[model samples]
Target: MSGYLADKNICCGCGACENVCPTKAIAMGYDDEGFLYPSLEQTKCVDCRACERVCPVKLDANKGYPDYLKTYAGYSTKKEVMEHCTSGGFATELSQLILQKGGVVFGVRYAKDYIKAEYVCVTQEEDLKALMSSKYVQSEKKDVYQAVKKTLLTNKTVLFIGCPCDVSALKLFLGKEYENLFTCELVCMGVTSYKIAEEYKEYTEKKNKAKLTFINARSKKNGWFVPHLEERFDNGKTKLTTLFGSYYGYGFQVYNRPSCFQCRYCDKNGVADFRVGDFWGIKETDEFWNPNGVSCIFVRTERGLALLKEIEERGFKLFKTDYEKATVNNMSSLHNKAEKYVVLREKFARIYKEEGLVRACKKTESFSVKLKRMLPKGMRAFAKKIYHKLHDKKTR
Candidate 1:
């Protein structure tokens, strides 16, 4: 353990430091299920502690939450912002606001050649769209953070967005370096291990017989909970596929980072100034086709609230709605709730072994026939809602 990344007392293992390293010396690999951390080849490291400098929990002289922040998830905004936004499109909104103030924002983007996550800058409107949605994979966002640091070090404002662990990684690496970081975190859905995203690319490339042009994880046209894989062939044909049930196995097919499945900071990880995520479990009717591109948002701090207001003030359609509150219990962590996923670790491992990472959802053979019968959209929604409600209640 030559640097801050290995510090048991402070390391959040977001992998930002590994990504930032120029030598390509550090690799992020999982321990058990899928938590992430930097594994270093000591010979390559020059003992910079560069990874430690940006850690949020480490950088904040006061990294703990305030008394008023206990068990709260809803921010001032109520309605989902964009159809494809993983949580609400609030992060983009906030980033845009900061840019309007002549600041820079850092977040993840898919590379033009590969569907993997890469760090990026949001300096203009076009750049903002790229920042939308949860990429749901491990990213090598080296350029993204470096860009933000370069701008902020010159006293420019910056709104950095990522999962809680990502935020922690960034803050830790930045240590005592910059004073103008506007850090925001996604109320994370545990990250699928890095290998999942990487393997999906490999699988799709061979399976589809085409080079993928875009792979949207949260396509509204598809189900938000289901991953929609889009493949563009050499002939220009675009096709979409779904991964509804086998996210874990598919995610682990490549190999996950060690710390993912057994995360520690989920309940009250003070990794970000504000946390955001899909406000799931909200009730709505068919008219609320707010699907396809809207996101539910939570503002977890005063800065977050102010950023939301600024976003709305700039002609973005902002709506207020009601949301359900999340508890330490009952939420399906999926990836980075960062810890407590282990009680069922064996069960998960068993399921994955049985089905692999990218299996399709269990098809309802009877419903398959019914769906092909050209059932009306309203009827389909009603039927699906009933099935989902019953299913959820039973699971509970």
Candidate 2:
């Protein structure tokens, strides 16, 4: 075990590091404020950098997340772009363009049927739809490295879209000279657990006395869809879950992996030519409220900027607006939250649940719960926020 970046800008919050950690020293830990960050059982660390190699941040640490990381408001006219996207289908549109130009784009796809993540290769237009929308579950696209390596061997360009860690893994696995790999990470707001989905299925199908039909989860009215839910009934009726609905955050929290509380990868570190996600603040422009929502866009390089412009010209939607940062984007805010909560996760893994931790982190359906980042101090603040948010959301 070696040290690695634990902040959100770099950490994809993927649990690879925790499992790969040999000493079992790296138990998932959380700070008091409530956000989870990895605390090292320094004794377990071999300092081999095995954890480092798999780190999305350390792979391109300095360049991985830029200090001047800026935001952009871009869009797509393609109805499908709006329909299928979590935010704007910028990622999908861009990915399709890359594939159309004889390139391969790699990104996480919502296994709607399984409701888990499966990394897929998008080479055809039809494949693009499958990859669109946010899964909310953790991406276990471990095959990404192999798929990318194989795609790159062909000499065609390859665009890999994921959280920072996924990109970092590609760089680490392929060596430093991955010329054809275009990496894109999202402004991750932590991940939830698969337990939420699994539990939902179990409770709905087994206990609810009704056939689980479908989920129109999240509160958004139109635009892109988030973890939309659908529960069907034999009478042909269905029910939906709002973003702040009873089924999402809290339910997810109850089921997320124990490691999530001690997640070392929850942080977002820079690693893509272009970073993209939902542009949350703006209500849908002309389009209906995007449930999956608009993709929040950030360009860290000229290459990213150029791609944005090209995609815009290629007929994606475009708008100009002042961008903002949530706790998700502010590193200082994260550090501030880190203090009191740092070691909580260490204690938690012992109690969070022994066997189900890893399984829960991979699927948010259990709780739509995943790990969020914070320094020890920040964790305390997060607790207050969660208390209030949950209280407020639950009552509403």
Q: Candidate 2: where is the Cα deviation over 4 Å? A: 1-52, 56-64, 67-70, 112-115, 207-228, 232-235, 253-268, 283-292, 321-396
Residues 270-295, candidate 2: write the lDDT tens digits. 55676666544433232433334555
- Give the true-structure RMSD of model 1: 6.3
lDDT digits (tens) for residues 1-396 of candidate 1 = 565555543444556666667676787665543444567788887777766565544554445744213222222232344554554466766776777788877888877755456677777866777777767666665445556667877898888888766776666556553557788776554555454555566666677677666766665555543344445677577765443323322343223344444444454554566665554543344222244333445455666566656666665554554333332122533234323334344444555556644432122113443352345434554655566567556654
TM-score of each: 0.70, 0.65
On TM-score, the candidate that comes out on top is 1
Weakest lDDT window of 10 consecutive positions for candidate 1? 67-76
> In candidate 1, how many Å is residue 54 off?
6.0
lDDT of 1: 0.55
67, model 2: CA deviation in Å?
A: 4.1
Residue 312, candidate 2: C-alpha displacement in angstroms:
0.7
